[model samples]
Target: MARGKTQMRRIENATSRQVTFFKRRNGLLKKAFELSVLCDAEVAVLIFSTRGKLYEFSSKSIKETIERYKRHKKDIQAKNPPVEQNKQHLQQEMASLMENIEHLESSKRKLSGEDLGSCTTEELLELEQQLERSISSIRTRKIQVFRQHVEQLKEKGTALAVENAMLRNKLSLQQERGSNKEKATVPSADISEVSDVETDLFIGPPETSRKRAL
Candidate 1:
């Protein structure tokens, strides 16, 4: 028996819906294959059941058909690029576009505002919490920067301490050398004292007369 005419609507009965889906799916695929064979033309069909199962058919490879479709779209666009030429009509479209843009902008502005009159209490609290978190993050970054600065200063102090210690050691060594030189050139007693006075007076060797006097 032939099937009766069916209403154009969702089939509420699960079994009937499933049977219909199977029958229609097979029929569509058969018709697609027949068309491809008869016309010597590429054909591709993609179907999805209500349950989300996929069915696909292509005379040539699906990828090739998709690539050919894309090339055709591009060639058509290149041949006749759509343009809005009439200024008044364009202005009317622009005015409509501007109205939509303004409406969206106003909505964005309203959402960004702090006025909680129209917003739910939960949303307001969430916004406030986010702001607090942002502030906390900023403060944490600030503290980290300060800590880095302090560490840099501490490193500089350590370097300066080492340099100061080296300078003090050099000064002490120079002072010790001066004291030793003064002690090594001490004067002898009596007439040697007189030669010593002469040697102290002059940096050269003691005079022969002074040595005889000693």
Candidate 2:
């Protein structure tokens, strides 16, 4: 005859519940032993009855199995750590960034002449003096740079003037040499004319010479 499936629930009778506990405990231990031996695996199982009786099974020493479990849990936690600590660290970094951003914004507002209502009279005076000092420094540096630029220009002008003088002197010397050459040519032509005239006078008029002899 086919029997119906037994309903899985707490047994109401004390004796029946105790009998079920014993049977289930023995079956569980037998299954664990078979799994370890067949698969060559390390196995551990623990059971506690309602009356606080402890039952356990282990392929090796229960203490060794417990230690191994603890080590495996630690390794898993190290590899995939809890999110709460990372969340806290990120929150702290976000708060610090927000504070820095706010500080920078406040400084920017002050520099732009906004948010002045919060400043005391002394702080205003100090800010004014600091601005004045910055302006003075900037103006002084500008003037120094201008002076340096002007000095450079003056040096350049002086060098150009000296170069111009040298060019003019060289041109004047060339012109003088050219003029001297022209004058030397003219003198040579005059000397040739004078020589011709003297020769004619010395050997001229044979009739005049015969008259003087007679």
Highest TM-score against the true fold, candidate: 2
**Residue pairs in collision within model 1:** none
Error of 2 at 46 (Å): 9.9
TM-score of each: 0.41, 0.52
In order, the Cα lDDT scores of the candidates are 0.84, 0.90
Cα lDDT for residue 92, model 2?
100
Stretches > 4 Å off in candidate 1: 1-80, 85-119, 188-214
Per-residue lDDT tens digits for candidate 2, residues 1-214, read 9998878988899999999899989999999999999999999999999999999999999999999989999998899777997799889999999999998898778767899899999878887887899899999999999999999999999999999999999999999999999988998888887773323343558888667556
lDDT, model 1, position 187: 50
lDDT of 1: 0.84
Which residues of candidate 2, in runs, are more than 4 Å off? 1-84, 188-214
- Residue-level lDDT of model 1, residues 1-214, one tens digit each, is 9988989999999999999889998999999999999988789999988778999999989999999999999898788665644566788999999999997776566556734577777867876787789789999999999999999999999999999999999999999999998877775434465653443343455575567557
In candidate 1, where is summed lDDT lowest over 10 consecutive residues?
A: 196-205
Task: Give the top-scoring candidate (lDDT).
Answer: 2
